[model samples]
Structure formats: structure tokens, C-alpha cells
Target: MAVLAVVSVAGLIVDDRVLVGAPIWAKSLKFSVSFVAYCLTLAWMLQFLTRRRKLGWWAGTVVAVTGAIEMVIITGQVIRGRRSHFNHQTPFDSALYNVMAGTVAVLWLATLILAVLLFRSTIADRASARAVRIGAVLGLAGAGLGFLMTQPTPGQMRGTSDIVGAHSVGVPDGGPSMPLTGWSTTGGDLRIPHFVGMHALQLIPLALMGLVALGARVPRLRDERIRAHLVAVAGAVYAAVLALLTWQALRGQPLVHPDGATLAAAALIAAGAALGSIAALRRPVGGNRAGTPERTRQPVG
Candidate 1:
């Protein structure tokens, strides 16, 4: 996928062709890079599942294979200068879309299986374990957002044959999009939240890394209990943000133009996260972390 992304980058620079109002190679690059992240993250995460490790490995394989298929179809569509998602202009296109949808369903189910395994397993680090569990759930939810986009728009439902669904709300796709992402700027865009939510798996872990580094300098944060509490707080905030983005998108509100209600909800989420963090930090640090459950040293596939 990384190699494909490199090719896509070159294509973007040399090819002037446009599809769906974006660079022809743009979606190819985006999906390829995203698959790289998704697959690599899943591979890293599967190592944590000491219990049902075999099942976890199988699930990861399913995710990787399906993801590869999705990328292939997307790139194939790009080469043909046709949009990959929601393109029902011809029988062939529709069949390809159906196949892609089937593969994605399999991938989603595999991811869910992996989530269950992770929840059943334990990690030595409480904070990491918590982060992993929460991240898995959020990641599933985020990826689930893709299904929301598959539903036909109101207009499509009313009367449409060439197209079946849309990612943009209150506006047609391929129109007035945000640069780079091609997200709708004129109205609500489901893709915005979808992107944000799907990355929780990586983002949460990355946040944990940052917190660990911070702990080296801050004496109080050195307590494992304290770090775990802070991680939980961060996870809560991240979940809230995901929910906020989803709500904003569904309301037909552009990300750049959040309504008063959206702003209020965001403010509440921020305030809640702040209070939660403070409460966590003020609590007494407990028990020696050396007695914590031991995490096995395992090589990532």
C-alpha cells in the first residue's frame, strides 16, 4: 500500500486528470495510505492478545486481505477515471461496488472479533490496556461510520438511478469540497467524522506515548495509577470528540461552520474532559506498579 501511495503521489504531480472534482490519484493515495496505517496498527495490536491469539491473528488476516481488496478496487476505479464509492452508473460498476461492500463487511466483522479478543486479554500496563480496549471500541464505531455513507441520500431515494448513495448531506458529492480531503464544505460531510473516528486506534496509542514521555519529567505523573487515570480521561475526551463530529455531520452542518448547538455541545465536552482530568490527577496514587500484571515481550508480526 505504501508503494502504491508513492505511485499515487507521482500520479498526482504528473496527471492533470480530475475525478469527482478532485485529483484523479487523490482517493487512491488517501485509501492506500489509510490502509497502510489500518493494517499496520492491527498487526501491532494483535500482539497484545495473548488469549485467543490465534483467533486474533486470523481476524487480523481477514482485515488485511479485505483492506487490500478495497484498495485494489479503488485504485482500479481511479485508473478508469470513475469514482469508486456509490458509483452505480453501469452494471459493472454496481457489481464492483457490491463486491467491495461484501469485503468491507467481512473486514468489519474481523475487526469486531479482534476487539472482543483484546477485551478478554490483559496487558501489564493498566493505562495501555485501558487505552487499547477503548481504542478498539472507538475504532470499530468509527469504521462503522462508513455504513452511514452507504445509505442513499434523500434525493437519491426520491429519484435516482445512476448513483445510489452520498457522503455529503444537503449537497451533492463532487461539489464545493474541502481541498485535500474532498470533504463537503458547503454542507455536512460524513467523511469528516469517519476519518477522525477511524484513526482512534492509532491516535490513542500515540497519546499514551506522549503521556509516558511527559511522566519522565513530572514527578507525580511517574505513578502508574496516575498515568492510567490520565489515559482514561484522554480516552473519554477522544470519544466525546468523535461523537461531536458525528452529530455535527448528521445535522447537515459544515465542519467549518458549526452551529450554536454544535458549539455548545463541543464546549460541554471540553468542560467535562477538563473536570475529569483534574479529578483523576487529584486522586491519591495507589499500590506499587511493580506488582502489576506482567506483559509478555512479543515480537510484532
Candidate 2:
């Protein structure tokens, strides 16, 4: 919530048009929100580990390193913008951003590895384990795809005259202007992949919930029912966000194409949630047995 508040306040204070033009505050706010979310997730996972089974300390360390790298990137961008005399671009800023992005990619890969290990250790039912595995795969795939799809081409960094023209809209040469929607593809096209990746936070947890719920219905797994229900409801909400993301992708979106891939992913997540829910519901109660000999002997006399 603090992170959200920062984003909201900064967004309001910063001129929307200037903010759209690779503004420092905007980037800072984004980093803050992402970092906060990451922290909260890590905290929850750590708590789970402590109460249930313990995950390696290395996982927490890796997360901390990644968070630190991200902070450096955000700080570098902020500093660069502040120090620029007459809108001069600094090589240091560009290099720091690249380094930060590269580090994040590495961290994401590490996260996938850790998630896989956790999945292996998870003694939960098939549904919960499957959800964790799927989420990890998605994160890994998204990062890999992003790196492959966005390879920088020659002359990619060269600024266009149109950018200067667009940046000049409704503002004095040095003053802030009204935020325009389409001019560059930096923020626009990037939204797709970012949205797809981030939504996993919701999708994965929810999937686990559904799994727990299903497991709870089984006589042997019934003890885990409460955990299952909670996770399933969470997964449902995440699935809804995935639907919204699909819509965002479809409109010839710049950063991330709302294409077949996005739709396919959404379908897969929805299917998992549905199947898990069904499995949970079908789980036999203690008093109301299933596949018993007594029931099979019915109508014999």
C-alpha cells in the first residue's frame, strides 16, 4: 500500500506528459511498487518455510541481491535525470539500466531454479505441486522470450526527429507538456511481457490454493483442505487478471503482443483452476464414503 501510495502521489505531481517521456519519478515509483511486492512475497514464503518446512537461506539471499540490483538501477536513472544539463543523456545511466536489466534476468532464472527445488520438496497433492511447477515454467519462459524477442538492432538507440517533434507538443522547449499516448515503444510495447510475468504472482498462489482444496477432500489429504480453499480462491482472482491481460495484448499492443501465446497461457491457467476446483468438490467426505462395497451392493436384493 505504501508503494501504491508513492506511485499515485508521484504520478499526480509529475506532469503526465513529461512523466510519459521516460520520467525518473515514474520509473522510481514502478521500482518501489515492484520491490515492495517482491518483499511481501518473500516474507510470506519465508513464513511458510518456517512454520512448515524450511527452504534454503540461499533463496532469501538471492532475492535480496536481486532487489538490491533493482534499487541500483532505479537510483541510477533518478540521478541521471536530475544531473542532466539541458537534457543531456549520460552513458552511465544507459549502462546502469542495462546492468540492472541483465541482473534482473539472471535473478529471474535463479528464482525458477529455486521454485523447481521447492516444488520437489512440496509434499502437497498433485494440484498444488503442478501449480508451482507451471508458475516457475511461465516465469522462465517469459524471461527467455523477452530476451529473444527484444534483441537490440543496429541504429535502435538513435533518436528520431519525430521524438523531438512529439516531445515538443504543448510545452515550451524546456517545460513539461501534456502526456501523449503513442510516440515511442519503450513503455507501450513493454507492458505486455511485464503484465504477463507479474500476473504469475496471483496465478501461482491461487493455483496452490485450489490444489490444497482438492487434496483436502481426499481422506488421506483432508487435513490440508483449508489451505486448498484459500489458495483456490486466490487463484481465481489471478485468473481474472490474466483475462484482462489478454485483452490488453490483443489491440496490437506495442511491448507485448496480445496474441495467441497470451491467450493460450490464460486458457491453461483457467483450465488448471477449473480442474482443481472440480477435483476438490469431488473429494469424498469422511461420513459420505465413495467406492465402498456397501454402495456397490445396492439393488442386489
Candidate 3:
């Protein structure tokens, strides 16, 4: 992870010039940093899942190798002064793109397997367990959205272009973008949901950790089940929001824009998720505290 972080920084410096409007290595740098963070978060969650079984080592290895392959392809393409994604300019480029896509598919499969393991395992802190499970599920959903980005836009299919798709809807690729993320500011960008969904592994667990810390400071929140319920609710709502974003982008609506339809949908999703969470809180999944050993119990953070 540390090595990847260093490589990400080096990419930013080496490819300082703008290639397709954005810095040449911008995508490479972003992928590198995101994967590094991903590796750390996955390793942390695996610690819990692997306590009873050793399958985590194999899953982690798959994750590490896939991530490394993706970074290599992205960085290699950037260094060659071409787009890393959606490019089919040459036979070699097409093959490279397909290989990277295959690697990502493998990574997602490994993640799903690990998530299932985490869900079935018994843990002292049910809250952390639930958070990890929800994170893994949402992360996979987000990754599934990547397929939408692979399809060509209506206009692109009509043209004789090497690349089949573009990230931006209304705006052309390599046009105006948001600062660090390079997300389209002038048009709907499918990458928004992809980015949001990919980070659930980190965000959900972090939110749970925050609750755990707060519970330590407050008397009423000492019950780990209460924290678990809250985390579950947050996860539900987070999933709804990701779906909403994907819907909005598909409609060619920019992230900053919110029409009456979008606002109404968001409100409905929030209410539905909240109601679901409340119902689940009443019926806890794991048995009440008796099975969990004292040595196994620890602060979620």
C-alpha cells in the first residue's frame, strides 16, 4: 500500500502536462491512491473474518494482484500519452483494456466471497460485522455500475471512433471536470456512483468506528447492538443514495442539479430506508451477548 502511494505521487509529478484536457497521469494517480486505501481497508476487515477461517489469505492475494494489474495498465497507458479507459485505438490497446476489465471482475468476485464469509461468521461486535457486510454488498453493486460506462453513448456508436464510450453525458470526455476527482461538472458523469460505491468498504466501517468511539464517551450507546442497528440504517440509506446518483446520471442530469423528480425520489428513499432500519433494530440477528467471549470483545475501532 505504501509503495502504491509513493507510485501515485510519482505519477502526478511525471505526467504533469495535460493530455486529454486533464493531467496525463490524473487517472493513474487516482486509481493508485484509491487501490492503496482499498487494500488497507480490506486487510482490516479480513482480520475479523479470518479469525475463524484462513480463506481470507487467498482472497486478499487475489485482491492485491488485481489491484496491482489495474494500476499498471492505467499508469502504463497514461505514460504512453493515451486514455486508459474506453480506448480501443489499436489492437494492443483493446487487449490491454480487456485484460484490465477482466482483472476488475476477478477482484469483485473475491470481494463478494469475503463478504459472504464475514456475514456468516460469529463476532463479538455485531455492529462491526454488519458494517463490513453492508460495505461489501454495496461495493459490489457500485462495481457493477462500471458496465454502464463501457457501453457507447448513442452518438459514439454512430461515429467511427476508436473509443466506444465517454464518461460525461452532455459534455465531451476530457472537457471540464471537478478539481481533484475529474468528475464532470458540466454534464452527468457515471463515474460519480462508481466512485461513491467503491469507497463503501472504507466509509461504512469508518462510520461504525465513529459510533463506537462516541458510545465509549456516552453511557446510553454502550450497547453494541444499538450501534449495529444504527450502522445498518446508515448503510441502507447510503445504498439508496448511490442508486439515486446512478439514476440521475443516466437521465443526463448533472450531480449539482436536482429536479422535482430527483428530490421526490430522494425523499422517498430516505423514508423507506429509515423505516426498514427501525424494523430491523427490533429483531437483532446474532444471539444476545451470551455466545461472544470476553477476550473476543473489543472496541470496533
Worst 10 residues of 3 by lDDT: 292-301
Q: Pick the candidate with the highest lDDT.
A: 1
Model 1 TM: 0.94
Which lDDT tens digits does candidate 1 get at residues 1-301?
Answer: 9999999999999989997778999988998899899888888888788798888888998898898898889989988988789989999999989999999999999999999999898787777887787888889999999899999889888886688878888888888987788888888999988898889989988877777778768766766667778888888898899999988888888999998999999999889988998998897655444755533222122
Give the C-alpha lDDT of model 2.
0.47
Which lDDT tens digits does candidate 3 get at residues 54-100? 78779888999998888888878876887778889999999999998
lDDT of 2 at 244: 54
Q: lDDT per model, in order?
A: 0.85, 0.47, 0.80
Candidate with maximal TM-score: 1
Question: How well is each residue in 1-301 modelled by candidate 2, as lDDT tens digits?
Answer: 3554375456548645343345545555555666676556544444323222334456666767886776655555464444221122456544555576677776776666566565556433434544444555554544443442233322333543211111121122233222422222321242344446654654575555544455546443443443344345444545455445534433333333335765676677777767775676565533324544221110000
Candidate 3: how many backbone clashes?
Answer: 0
Off by over 4 Å in 2: 1-23, 46-55, 82-89, 125-127, 143-145, 148-150, 153-188, 207-301
Rank list by lDDT: 1, 3, 2
TM-score of each: 0.94, 0.56, 0.88
